[model samples]
Target: MKQQLPKNFKPKALAALIGLTFTLNHASTIAQEAEPETALETITVTAQKRTQNLQEVPVSVTAFTGDEMAEAVIKDMYDLQTNVPGLGAFQSQSATNSSFSIRGVGTSSQNFGLESSVGLYVDGVYRARQNSMINNLVDVAAVEVLRGPQGTLFGKNTPSGAILVSTVTPSHDGGDSFVEATVGNYGLVNLSGATSISAIEDVLAFRVTAFGSQRDGTIDSVGNGSETGKNLLNDRNRWGARVQALYTPNDDVSVRIIADYADIDEICCGAPVQLSNATINPDGEIGSDLALPLLGGTVFAGGDAFYDREVAVSFLPESTMTDKGLSAEVDWELDENYTLVSISAYRNFESFDNIDTDFTDANLFGTYNDSKQSSFSQEIRIDYTGDNLNYILGAYYFTQDLDLDYSLYTDTFFNEFYMSSLGGALDDLFAGINAISAATGGAVAPVADAAPAGTGFDHQAKQQHESYAVFGQFDYELSDTLTLTAGLRYTDETKDLVTIFSENLADGSQSPEFFNSTTELIIGAGAAGVAAGNIGAALAGGQAPSAEDLAALLPFQTAGWGFQ
Candidate 1:
């Protein structure tokens, strides 16, 4: 089964929800002996690694307040895009991974080799990959969408831009907690709650927040009215919690620790039925030998051609995914003009095994087990606020390790029977079989052999990456309101990827069929062939191998291209 995300959400309704929730919750926080509302204290932002008025930041940034986020049901990164302009996200038609694009800069291809062009960071910890975007985040303070090139401040392959997420920290405000829930169409339900408490009078505090959501499928299966079997299978469910503790011994110094986890479970995704082009014939023939004439009555007693022409998403699975992570951040104020900050984080994400794509009724494939990926990072920064010249400096370090095990199966007989049933010895193997039946003067078409049972191919890949960067930004008050800012960063990154392929078939012996086949085609035609791998392989191969050659090869393996 295939799935598509809702492109247009109810923006007005989302805004109304956030507005109402914020009004109700904030009404309780209003102070009685309040100082005169001195021009509604402008909200300051520190996203640029420097403190400045939100409006004075020389960048295209969409800042979402906690009030706006609550009103729009913006519990996580996925929901945040609904209100931000020029930003979009979807579970690709390929995997449970989210495809994100800002101003059309994201990768459209589904290959895992290429990560997203946009960087995602939570609490100063860079989310190294895409699967982490699968679930809702808990206790978010604010989300900043920084558009355009940000490599100077954040240099993790974000050719487009980056999303900076900051979560709420524990406060000294004495209080219990509160909870909220939501119900909607498609069995949609959401529950969220949070609370804060002072552990030591004005010295120590702790806060906790959590969220969960679930929904049934909106699409229906046509073959069988089996709604139960498919409803929740294609739906989504996610939940997570965060806890934080803050300690302030004096007015100039503070320490904080925070941890969080998130998970998403939903059937994998599949592409839509868009278009189909005829497979090219190698005999210089425009169509297949089995191609049916216009009349069509002569073939198979007026029935349609034996082969059906349809556009299909080759092999997909009913997939589920889980994402979880933890991180800690600390802030220290040295005197009045100097400050320091440090953050450390770790994250893990994986996708469950299942079949989500239905290429043809004859051949189907599924994932065998969950694929896992993990990463860790640390960063430190120091800044000083000066009257004439303001400056900030920072250094970052990151590491990641990944382990993936996946499988594919071709479990139906129709495909093998259609192409390989004819025996090699005689003009027609069906002749002898029909002759025996003719002895009784009865007529019956020759029978083809039952399609061979499906074959299985599995793969394991391990990847490691390390990166470091040092950056500095300086701002000069050129005039009074006309400030000039400039920044620069130096970064180095290295990646090591190793792939292991193992084949499982009727023979029981393991071979590197899948890897050999794909790599051969990719490396054969040089860069030109590699470029074609981005689109279609058969077209790149040019010379289609015989069915016999293809059958002898590993299932899901390519034949025409040579291995490097």
Candidate 2:
């Protein structure tokens, strides 16, 4: 309305209208502000020692939360392959150790002088042995699989990668506890129980966890269909517990102690069944024995005589393992920006008479060998860490003393017995030849040589090794998005190898030298005894056999009886 009202009337009416407008707009603004927040949540992880967004960490890492572990059925590092890419695990049937490969770089050698490319650590304490590293890994807060050379911050010999396992620490508030049980295929059963007690309110606390698992075997014996052998190639019954006590007298100072023990009785069985046996061809001609044959006894047609049979056997023993250890550490906050920490640990592990790897041929015509090993390890380290630039300066001293014994049981008796038996049969043929020669009016040949006698090879070797290593690693962040890592280690390895040989000689004085010169040569020469003697004498005198010489000796030595 363009019409002007009395000044008082207009002011009163406008004021009322403005008041109504303010209330409506204020309500609408409040309604708009009350709408819920619509942004996704961000996750933080301690992959670099400091808390940072998971996606922001520059290095490649795979983190598994406790819940994720359960979902994936991951019980330990050996179960890590299901979730982690480019990683695989294999346990040794001949030793109390495991092989972990990352990008195909892990070591397959179980020698005391060698170190694994993949490093394993629990609660910051390095696990020196493979069996010990498989200790009860339950109740873990998270597991971080650090890929690439982790030599920078995690210590030495991690040229391939590293696995860091962290357990849940005790709560300062009045403690809590839980119990759970699980069962699976092949009679699998597992039980775990834990409780935390506030020993001294917020000043001190203790947490204890116990667990057990058992399962039936998965393999059925192929030879005799017997259930007597270990069924599960990797089946085991395990039980263990851990006690961790923490004391925080003040917010600035703290001390912690940890003790653990575990027993693992497993039947490890695995064999490498793939191999190639290469041999030299007899001659340069295409018709030589090296060439593939054809039928109907002709070069162009395939035949049954061309086929060869190949048989292979494996020799490995079942293995069992046990482990126990104790450790402690102290953390002192020197200031908000600086802190110092000291860590000390002690460990003892013994494989006992656990593994037996004698899976070879024990027949009269084959070979058999027995092998076993025992090893002990000890280690100690000290280090430090901080902000912006996080670095660990430490000294690691490691020592291992190991012993290995082996023996070979050959069929020497059977070899000798069979050769004599075969020689008797061959001798009967010689008499027939003499009669045939007399009737035909041809010259009769003398006796043919006997075949080479039993057990062609035999020997044994034993070795002991003592080794030590001192190592360290350094990690530095150049910027907010990039990091530079470097490390080096020195290892001292020593081995004492001994070889012992034996044979069932009727008179202990018989050796390969005497046997080969007389018995072996005579029998192997067959009907060519006289010609072979001359040829052998010429060879002994350093004279080579020429084509002409071979041709001249063929009929007497190799051709007449189809003996070539």
Candidate 3:
């Protein structure tokens, strides 16, 4: 080559060879680097009663894994709304009064007769009560929020949406444990832990999870004498524990048993009073100002009530809830493409709320409510998986018994407020009754009590609900990415309620005759009076009146008694 080389041919050939070698080396390096270390995670969900990839499900749903929830600091159902669009959840003065709404449709009524529009299911067991729906999530595997009517899959009272929660399944592989702690402002402290162990190697496993949290109240309680204190309203105190056991007798059959208990005891929910222009009376004086003397000159926070976070409550608001349940789930693989599942569960819930109805330093009125429910349910389903078609057929049975004891009472200040508002008319009436009694030689009891302190009504109610349903859904694939779906559910339900009412006097005596006569007179006056009488009767009978009843009675009572 050095002796017989064309002038430029040798140089050009050398350069082309070097360039080809460098291109080959660069392509080899890119091939090696393009190989990914990990692949994207695939999410699985059970929205259609069968495990399927999230992207494959046709329903409008949002899902979150345990790690995601922990990362977002989601502790309870109320925190779910922060991540779920068009979903709203609120815990009122008590967990028993919690509400969940989807797309602006929900049942906010605190009536036991009404069920939630948005259904809640945990580990495939339906939770019918709001009190049971607010428990802290522990050792959770996943949560799915399905929007729009889910009645076909979930049964009754799911016209709005559904929430599905799945707990971690104990593994027979090895032992794992974790503990987490959190601290924040307002004396917040949270501790949670989980432990899983293989009990019988490849055959049986067990898991335990527990959590507890406490935090100071956001609203300050001030200027309420002995009732004044920090963290007296809207505080948080709760704890829960769950135990699970899994038995895999063989590859084709498996069984899981779970038991859980949760409790919440806290002070909650007092609203600061705010006066607006509409509160001005005909005399150009703020309506609330008329009761300033009765309230002992106590002033709620001025300006924005929420920003101020100050309330003048004579009694500390109290809310307590307890929930416990046991469930057993069995899965049997019928064949390569079919599976059978059976679930049986029993649950109990109890809650109590003592609230300052007047929301003022003055002990005018208050409420005490104690509620309990026990429920049992059983479900069986068969799932079939086919290349071009999938379907689920299920039958469900559920029954529950509910009992409630409720009361309303007022103190001396209530009578005083009424008397002053009526310009001493109550005093005059009492005097007239005394004179009549004196003339009758005590034959007529001198309206002795004059609706004294602790005078109100007690209501007791019992309700039983039973339901049976058969539901089925199917998905048929028409193409690789397009599918047709259809579902149907038929339900038969029966409900029974028994309510008893009784009135209480200052001396704690029943006055059914007096109450009935007074209620009749009030009913004759107008619709408002009729509603108040009914509410009063409900209270006297020891029944928990609905919020609507209370709201209707509040204005009527306030206007008639001259104090709110």
Highest lDDT against the true fold, candidate = 3
lDDT of each: 0.58, 0.51, 0.71
Q: Which ten-residue region of model 2 has the weakest summed lDDT?
A: 21-30
lDDT order, best first, reads: 3, 1, 2
Q: Where does model 2 exceed 4 Å of error? A: 1-52, 92-97, 174-176, 224-233, 270-316, 352-392, 403-564
Q: Which prediction has the highest TM-score against the true structure?
A: 3
lDDT of 2: 0.51
Question: Per-residue lDDT for 1-564 in model 2, tens only?
Answer: 011122222121111110000011110000111224684444455555444556766668888766567667787766787689877676554335567777777876454335578877776666656556664567676788878886545544678888777776666543246566766656667777666778898899888878898776443222211123434444657888889998999998888888888887765443311110112212222433232111101121123211111111222245555676777777777776556666566666555323222222222233232333344344443334556555444444444343433233233223333344445644544454444335435433333222122322344555565555655555577787777766566666666776655543323322233223445434533544444444445555777534453333333222111111
Q: Flag the better candidate by TM-score, 1 or 3.
A: 3
Model 1 clashing-pair count: 13
Instruction: Tell me model 3's lDDT, rounded to 2 decimals.
Output: 0.71
TM-score of 1: 0.72
The CA lDDT at 518 in model 3 is 42
